[model samples]
Target: MKKHLILLLLWAVVGVSARAQKPATVTIPKNKYGLQVVSSTALYQQLVEQNPDQELVELATYIPGLVLDIKYATPDNLVKEPVYTMATAYARKPVADALKKIQEELKPLGLGLKIYDGYRPYHVTELFFKKVKKKAYVANPKNGSRHNRGCAMDLTLITLKDGKELEMPTPYDATVKQSHPDYPHVSEQVKKNRALLINTMQRHGFTVFHNEWWHYDFNEWPKYPLMDIRFEDLKAMKN
Candidate 1:
């Protein structure tokens, strides 16, 4: 009878373990009209569990002979440089598709998008506000932000032929008058590249924020939800 009692105890323990292992879901109180927030702890697992027939963004436009890596390119595990990567589907599938469409349009001109920022978390948004003042180029963390919703992105133009960056007048995060729209003394190339980005993204249904040259929000961003989920969660969701 001792063996029977032990088996009963073992079964009880397994029952409790199974109950405890249930995944938790984070319920978002609200989401933007065009965008949906991904707040659930189980979101990553849920996305991967499905055999969704998702399309990889069509990459029809390749720089004829360009090895077009961005400033974020990392040399190796040694951490020699920053890592360059294309935006993945989990965060903003539409944005990824937009990039592909932009690439297709610009292939003839030998230009490509060199993305600097996309799908930023609230934590990163807070950090950004700390570094840059709000008057000129600002991203407030308290209220809604594009990066928070994964509906906005910042990018610049690069030569598709040699993969070298073009002249943007100022580098990323400059936040000065030169980066302003009315700062007329800049080169025509700067304006042209900026316009190219604006027109292309707008064609693909993105709304441009006038103050900043590189900033864009999807027209459908209101349908998406805010995502506090980290980079790891995004990767997990992609699988």
Candidate 2:
């Protein structure tokens, strides 16, 4: 009887822990953003295309104004990006929801999200690995990437009034140390703006990777799946 009672108590404690974890839990839906905090499962379907293996390519449901990414476009692979500036969100819902909150908080200041990339195909990740080495900003295709997992994003800030990419210390995939947000030569205003973005993201539910100014992940990233589904496969699924 004592053993059974102990097991019951342990079960009760486990149940309570799970409830506490829900607030921080993240879900992976078709193309929605935010690492966790997903409360639904109505996934956006990927449009299928004819492939060698009779597979399909899938894409996330894009919020209006955002363009599907073309840099990595190929029947072999497809990358999608959210529209910049207008707040026609490009990230998955959890990410979108988080951005929406930031928008509400930053709109009065004339600031907004200028997304460049999201939902990277594993093939593109491999392409980066093939071109860029594993030092600093570079990643290894064999090891896997956060973007491939759909939990990471490459982004920057912009003004709704003028659609220009903000002046950051370095360009995307820049391998130089000068690109670090803390580079001494970078203006204090830029640093301040970077900090505001980082802090705001952290406060809302993200953890910033110190080396990269624009990279952040939901605290629950480990729970998500690492996907290598090619754009072609996604397209084939759509059919």
Supply the TM-score for candidate 2.
0.60
Candidate 2 lDDT over residue span 1-239, tens digit each: 99999999999999999998664323344333322221122222211111121111122343323223233332222213321222211233465556557666766777766555555555555566555453567455555566655566666776767756567777654567766656677788777777787787888787766577766775655544455454433444445
The lowest-lDDT stretch of 10 consecutive residues in candidate 1 is 51-60
Q: Write candidate 1's Cα lDDT for 150-223 as tens digits.
A: 67776677777677777776776565667754467877978777767778888998877766666788777765
Name the candidate that leads on TM-score.
1
| Runs of candidate 1 exceeding 4 Å displacement | 1-26, 29-38, 43-91, 134-136
Error of 1 at 69 (Å): 7.5
Q: Going through the candidates in order, what is the number of backbone clashes in each? A: 19, 26
